[model samples]
Target: MEGEEVGIRHQTDGGQKTTYGATGSRPSSGDERTAQIAGTSDSAPVAATDDGTSGLKSAQGVPAGPSTSYSDAVGLSSRRKKAIFLCLALNSTFVMICIAVLLPFFPQQAAKKDPSDSGDVQGASAIGFIFSITPLAQFFGALFVGRIIPKTGPKMVLMIGGVLVAGVISLFGFVNDIDDWADFLVICYALRFVQGIAGAMNITATFAVLVGLFPNNVSLVAGTIRAFNGVGFAAGPVMAGALYDAGGFTLPFLVHGGIMFAGTIWLFFTLPGDAEVGTGKKGNKMFKDSFTIPWSFVWCMTMFICGTTIGMLDPNLSPFLEDEFGLSATEIGLVYLVFAGTVAASAPVTGYLGDRYINPNKLQPPSMLVLCLGLVLLGPWAETNLTSKLWRSIISLVLVSIGFSSGITLATPGILNAMHKAGYEDTLELHSNLGGTVTALWAAGLTIGPTVGTTVVSAIGFPKTNAIFSIPVLCVATLGLAVGAAYALKDLYYRQRTGTYSLERQRLLPSKDQSTAM
Candidate 1:
């Protein structure tokens, strides 16, 4: 016991260095003192009060979080960042394709499977039930994926997710072989639910990985991935249509599924090292530090609005274009392409600015305001008694798409940035948890959106509904922007005086038992 070694904790606050030995033995003991608090030096221990330990702890007797600034916390290599970005791009570029490829192709195919369904009414209904299973499953699955990420590690979770999604999708091609309607519905629904859970896993882990790897350049990285997401969504129908034309219904699923599998393969080789993504001390915890900081809710609300609006348009927009503007299905699809293009084009630019110059609060609110204006214009100036013009509609659609892109890009990083100021640990699990919170809400919004779009539009008409939706967005954006600005100023003032943006919260830090290795 005399010659045995013990760990000692050190902290420097206001030019004072305090030391607390784990065994309460003085440095005069024949033992070694390891300087392990973010590599701070083994400076001479000070003559301290409270047994040299009470000030270093919290009321709960848990060890305090680090006092070091975020910039000094950790460093990641460029090679690792590239590996992460590749994994994200591949995953994003293919998952949506796998998901969306069925949209333009499945209902008619399923309807034909039933001999009595000549009119295809029951087919449409049954197919809708099948398609809806995935998102609904994902809604619940998002709640648990974060907890799993910290245990299984992100890379493995991602691998399993990718495999599940790809496997389910590839198996879709075999559905044509089944003739009985009941059996077909059962198989389709089962596959969809499996893929849905897989999607939840993939998205949650991908976001968590991004947060840990590219904390400094989050906006650009997120924006780039989002760009790929839009591309995949836009390309899915086009690819499906083309492949169906060439190789029939089975080809589209097989091709898209194969693409997703390729992404999974690339991810296996590229991601450098695998570990449980986060501190993951808590699973599916929503807003882990909301009491300390409340910004995550604001972004969550923004995303909910965005998702609902997207869902709203998906059900109503094409018909509106056809009936109101006399556009054909092809033209309407081109308009949809334009919308996706705007999102893809603007996301990275907006994200780059968010990282370098603009703050998330300032960026998101204004972008939503732009969306509000676009919606109003799309609504024929919202009760101004003028008919909506085609050009104006296109412009409005572009604005709406860009706003959606900006809000999505802001959601995760915006929440995480606010948390860091409160001194949340930068663990993969932490990112996954926050990511799960926003993701679940977004899925909820989408789930509710179609119903709202149909009912609201029918009740008050499109123009009034668009105008009404703009009001809540405007109110939320104004409040969020104001709060963001206030915090920005507060952070600036805090940094100018104390030399750090963080309050350096102490309760959230790792316990001494957890740090004996480092």
Candidate 2:
């Protein structure tokens, strides 16, 4: 390292290395730390970098600064890269489609099961409960992934979860056949719960693998996967609508189950096998770091909002469209194309901008505002004749879709950068922990969004519920904008005047202890 100081290093071989970044030499043990080992506490941090030959490239001359691309410092063979991408990308596409297949029809069926029938509140609340149950299971399942990933490794967990989820998807087909409301409700809830566990497992594992494989290009990786995920979102409705017309309620789920099973088998053949890869006695810390990490809350809020962008619509939106527009299930599913299609296109751009130009955090607030605008129009609460216009609904869906996908795509990469700045090492364990934590928060949002959206819609109707929800999102967007602007200015000052910047301060300047430390 020349003409710079290193703030953090994640080398493969574990060797004593020269430092770069803010100071020409390393800081005292008290002033700095690296990534937390799996079970380790704040003590016993790993310092220095490894040789270039391992999966990660050597960082011998590179500086850990703002301008540096993390992916550029990491390396992978072409074959391995292909295997990782194909296995994970296909998995994401199929999983999202499977998760989405029910959105167009299930709420309508649950609405019918409503015993009170006293308007929409009671039914909406019950239906919301049914819809929310799956993500609720996923919230816990994320925690479960943290504990198991080290012992069984992510590969086994991904496989098991995939197979199990496929079974749940297959079994859900039987629910519509039950005539009894109690049995139908019970079966639906049970299947959703199981599905949530499977989903959490699959998603968490997938994220861990991506993080491990592309530690440097996290933003790009997240963006690419999200693009595929958006495609699944776009396709799910079309597939469901067509399948329902072909075989009624049973066919969509059965087809989804088959697709999921096939994807799982592909993964089993593709992903690498795992040995005992636990960090140490502190292996539990990898799971616990979700709480201990200083900026975990920041990522949590963004991740939650990302999830709600999709979730808030799931419990009630389809039925609202049906009642307001006189649309059939198939038609309702087609309407979803507006939302999912926009997501498919915009998510990748959000990621690219975050990586190539502005900070990922800066991208979020604007997208949130876009979402707020969409929600307002979705309700058509403008108090005019156009309030119920179908075109207004389409435009609103598109905006909401953009916000949803961008929010998710930005959060993962942003957290990785933030963690690196906060003095956490960019290691596989660290990435795995982050994946689990973020997934947990995302699950929480998905659970809460539907439950709250339904309950509120019951009270004020969907239009009013959407209108009111927009208020909070608007507030958050405003705050994020102010904060993001301040940081952007700070970075500009550091880069232009001082000539270089890392997370903490300008690397062109030296720390007070540089004399003694060097």
lDDT of each: 0.71, 0.68
Best by lDDT: 1
Work out candidate 1's RMSD over C-alphas: 8.8
Query: Model 1, stretches more than 4 Å misplaced?
Result: 1-77, 114-123, 276-279, 284-292, 485-518
lDDT of 1 by residue, 186-222 (tens): 9999999898889888888888777666666788878
List of clashing residue pairs for candidate 1: 65-506, 65-509, 277-428, 277-429, 278-428, 278-429
Give the per-residue lDDT of model 2 (tens digit) for 145-238: 7556645667788889899888998898888778777787788888888888888888888887777666545677787888898788678867
Which candidate leads the pack in TM-score? 1
Model 2 spans > 4 angstroms off: 1-76, 104-128, 175-184, 244-252, 280-296, 319-331, 382-388, 482-518
Q: In candidate 2, how many Å is residue 433 off? A: 1.8
Candidate 2, lDDT over the whole model: 0.68
CA shift of 390, model 2, Å: 3.5
Clashes of each: 6, 15
Once all C-alphas are superposed, what RMSD does model 2 give against the true structure? 9.2
> TM-scores, in order shown?
0.79, 0.75
